[model samples]
Target: MKFNYLVFFALCGFLNLSAQEYYFPKANADWEQKSPKTFKIKDAPLQEAVAFAEANEYSGSRDLRIAIVKGFEREPFHQILGRTKKRGGPAGMIIKNGYIVAQWGDTKRVDMTFSVTKSFLSTMAGLAEDEGKIADTKDLVIDYIWDGTFDGAHNSKITWEHLLQQNSAWSGELWGGKDWADRPPSDGDIDDWKLAQPKEPGTVMEYNDVRVNVLAYSLTHVWRKPMPLVLKEKVMDKIGASTTWRWFGYDNAWTEIDGLQMKSVTGGGHSGAGMFISAEDMARFGLLFLNNGKWKNEQLISEKWIKKATTPSTPNANYGYMWWLNQKGDRHWEGLSENIYYAAGFGGNFIVIDKEHDLVVVTRWLEPSKVGEFMTKVNAAF
Candidate 1:
């Protein structure tokens, strides 16, 4: 018995020693900055990368007000943060081996990150599974959520795995928006969308905010608290993130939980009100994953959960649990690892993780088409 305990302690000791290798950045925007030369990264390509990024920043609407009306061909969702707080500009940083190799723009500005918020929502689901709030991803979601949201026959077949992989095809109206109305085809009308038949759950992958919201709502129910609070206490605070970051949902998203009313946050800012955070804060979140969910001797989220989170869904090889993966090597330059995955949002916001290079990259307002070129340049530097 003593020897058995000794083995357990020995393994724990090894894990603790390995955890110290990750460098968690400082808060208050005091994160250390290092030059490419310091890391033996080439000077020319690094400069070219920065210049390329600066010259080809996202030209889309920096304001959600204009972006929604002009880009989506729809109005804002029922509830959202006021339009005044939205600030859009080019900002980013590149971290190699857990240190900042290069950065540009206003990394401190809080802006709308749109669908990048989905990745954070994915993290919340990981937490739920870790805490046993969700026993199995394959278990039907209707089993846990007693509400009528999953009452229909089509919806009843949906499971947490289906939802996380964007293959649930969950049918229901949420916050005055129908599931199909979120992103109909170019020529498809709302009337046509409403009558559209949903594919069998787990058979098709579709990016729908309504279904994403269902995941958020279900998670909020299981947690019995606001998601922002859960994120802060469980993740942001643990990673030494700044206090300024916020997670929000629509205005009418409030519900009674544990005898108290709380707002159910959205996974992305498609309509509005997702995550408003700085680039540094986003990097810390990426670093946590680059280290396989270990944060300084503490396994805040289980490594098993992270593996599932990053693995490509069977139905969608390029997407994993709300995270976009570069499985085909199409989005990145050649010679880079296929293990590269990222959280991408509208306005070209990206949190790219390259495990092979031990790198984390955060970029805001970069031109969508130039991402590969920028990455190619970054790779050249190293």
Candidate 2:
């Protein structure tokens, strides 16, 4: 009777192991695909979502350098300070229950992801938190780096959480970029913005690339190595992301850490350099998040970190740790779940994660205004 009980338990374990649901695409191999019908998804709505993305291509010129200047024409000294690439046409893939249900255009073409890089940057911080590198999110920046970066009275109160939530209001210049010059208030003149009183740390949310770069700079100092290398060795390589992907920094963005000169990557392509990656890889990243940071059997990032990263900040209900939330705020999608959160970038690049449906959608070069509607259409099929 004891032998029979043991045999029954072993059989149950085998059955549970065989019941794994998610599918992770192998590196350099053909990704497995499935039909929408397999999951009872409405094919017409799914196809319409793809067509809507393709038809609503970003109005910006394929020449991103020109687009960069034209889009941020208001900001003073906004030049292509780093490498910018001519982008490919509309491209995307829809992952439902871990298999590709639909794909459009060139999925493998490497293109600039612009501010979508912030999500990855946030992941670095999450990894740090998981590893105890960042002792606490509330810890003051000056505690980690005694440099004059956090010397000012207002800047002294800035914390890691504030930086991650885009509310740090970090005041200073780094890599030839001034804190106030980035995406300044439209109603103010250059001198007015420069002289404007900085907001209290954690009091307001501002989307400033200069401050984002400061976070990158701090993370670089914390890791004691290049952020890109840390990303590749720790996350990307483990997730089987393609070799075609690259993270870049401004030409002048370099620092000496431990007597070794390491380049600190930017969190966005506002000044031109950031993550240049394919749509498939972006989907893979979204899948990792959908699985709560677990890549297959290994947890690349902790679930605790993900919860903290996705929770809405007091300043911005629609924003998290560099990730945009669909929490019925100004940026919320009309019909989509409030739980949906995504990484958005300039020129309509996105990595949308819908964990409720086990769905991951990556789209590039779609019109920025059409994103909420596109998501609405995509979710309709499910």
Candidate 3:
């Protein structure tokens, strides 16, 4: 039995070594090496903020203090990549009282934000509504999109609200097929890829990427500009996101779709996928939403729009207009709350805002381990 135990321990050590060697990059990449000009928190008293973050118990080894301290000197993106690659854990950021208080891992590194881009798209939809470019969420997509090619019996019933809520009933397979990647669609061929719609819209909460693509298409049809440009001129510019950040789309005009270059997409835009930005800038976005779309005294996104975007319009928990709602309940289950909304991407990219506590947390990483525990610690600190 003792020999068996020894063998087991040896195997475990080997596995750990392999994991470390496999995941971590040998030489630090650009994201892993960039640092923020200012890493200090300006909202609450600094000592108190530090104490609060220190009080929380993260699930990792307590010996992590040395690494955490080393992170202070490292670039935010590198720190996050290091932790994610080494520990296979989530990165974190915390904003309290309108100032960034604490962060862990590669807090500033930008990665694919996955569905979180949906929330941004939803905000744009609201802007369109406010501009009278779109009448309302209930407006049929055909109203905005030209060609009316998608005006089938099933698709005809799809509305802006249906798409926003991820209930457009479109098959995800159409966009996600392996073959589809090889034969990329032409600039104008996006409409030809539309698939058969489901039986009903809004009856089920199906997370469909194609619906988001259609939303982008609809936006382009109305604004006569690419989705990214609209987002840049309206959202990113208004919020003062750093020039370092890039939102991907087709053509430099924002209509081109190179899968690798464009991270944020309409469904999950290219920019959002690998949207690169400093963690501080991501915190700025959180603060902008926390203040109900006001940044530096500028009314960027309207309060009404913010509220509507974060509020869950479907039965799905933690699902708002493309944002994830984080409520206080079972950690495994969904449904955060109206007070806390987040822009979450896959592999654990997050921009979390706690309105009641005046807190925002942003994290970017390559994996999803320990995210729950990290979030728990952050919540406790609040």
Candidate 4:
């Protein structure tokens, strides 16, 4: 009787493992796809959700310049003098077990993915830590970036953890903008812009682009190479991502790195230069996280790093290390898993991953406010 039970249990385990097997496509325009029915996903509701995403227009101004002028957008200080364009229409893919279950629009067209680049930056930081370049996440930033960036009493107290949690509030001018000017309070004054009484690091969770760029510049100091190149060679190529994707910095972000001039990349396209990537490529990135940073036999990113990256910040439970946590009450839709986290960008770009369901969903040019509704419809089908 014991032998029979053991055999039955082994068979069940094998079946479960077989179901989790994934198919990663080769690097090219040709990639295989699967229907929703293949995974027992209800076809009609999924179709309805896609149709909804297709029809609904983005809530922000079509011309991003208008959005910026009207205070509806929080882009970099340089966007006014930089390149800006009307965003493309809705495009996305829903992947189940690494197979494309549903896709719409031109998945290959590379488009600007605003703050989604933050998550990519977060990944780069993880890679730095894994490579032993940055020994500890809790260490003082001034230890590596010895420049006067974190010199003051309050700034000197800042650590990598504080920056990751958006609580650093590190004060300084970066790329020509004061720390407070990036996303200043509506009633901010000159004193506010100067950060005369900057909040103590780790006690405030302010989403300031200048401070984020400070983190980016610090990463440049640690890697001693252009961030885009490091990311391309280490992460993108490993996952078979297309070469068309580009990560950019501002026009004037060049700096001398060991006698070679290198541009310090931004974490997001706040001032018009961030990660411009295809939906398919972004889907591949999301799949990496969905698989806990593994790609087939190779571990592209450490599972430990991914866990810390997704862990909620103490000050902001709905926010992780640049990745947005799905811990919000509105994020709880039927069939949604507990550990879902996502990379969200401006203009309604989102790369949501459900590790529990082994799913990845990428959306571009979607209505920002309707994301919850759209995902809820998709979850209802599950």
| Model 1 accuracy (lDDT, Cα) | 0.83
Tens-place lDDT per residue, model 1, 1-382, is: 2468656876878444334555677666478777778768898998888888888878766666776556667522433433225565788999876788889899888887888999999999999999999998889998999889899879999999999999999998887667876777766566766687999998888889889999999999989989999999999998998888888888788778778988888888877788999898999999999888877667898999988988888887888889888787334445666898999998789999998778899988898888877888888887
Q: Record all residue pairs in model 1 with backbone atoms less than 3 Å apart, i.e. clashing.
A: 79-251
TM-score of each: 0.91, 0.95, 0.64, 0.91
Which of the two, 1 or 4, has more lDDT? 1
Alpha-carbon local distance difference test for all models = 0.83, 0.91, 0.54, 0.81
- What are the per-residue Cα lDDT tens digits for candidate 4 across 1-382? 2468656866877444533497776787576899889989999999998999898767777666665455434433534423455667789999989998888888998888889999999888899999899998999998998878889788889988888778997877877866766765666464545546787787768887778878888898899989999899998998889989888887788888899999888877666678889999999999888877878878889989998998888777778889888885544444556588899988889999987777889999897888878888878778
**Is 2 or 4 the stronger prediction by TM-score?**
2
Which ten contiguous residues of candidate 2 have the minimum total lDDT? Answer: 11-20
**TM-score of candidate 2 relative to the true fold:** 0.95
Q: State the lDDT of candidate 2 residue by residue for 134-199, as single tens digits.
A: 988889988997889898788889999999999999988889888888887778578988898999
Model 1 ranges with Cα > 4 A deviation: 1-20, 74-84, 188-190, 329-335
Pairwise TM-score winner, candidates 1 and 2: 2
Instruction: Give the Cα RMSD of candidate 4.
Output: 2.9
Q: Between candidates 2 and 3, which one is better according to TM-score?
A: 2
lDDT of 1 at 92: 92
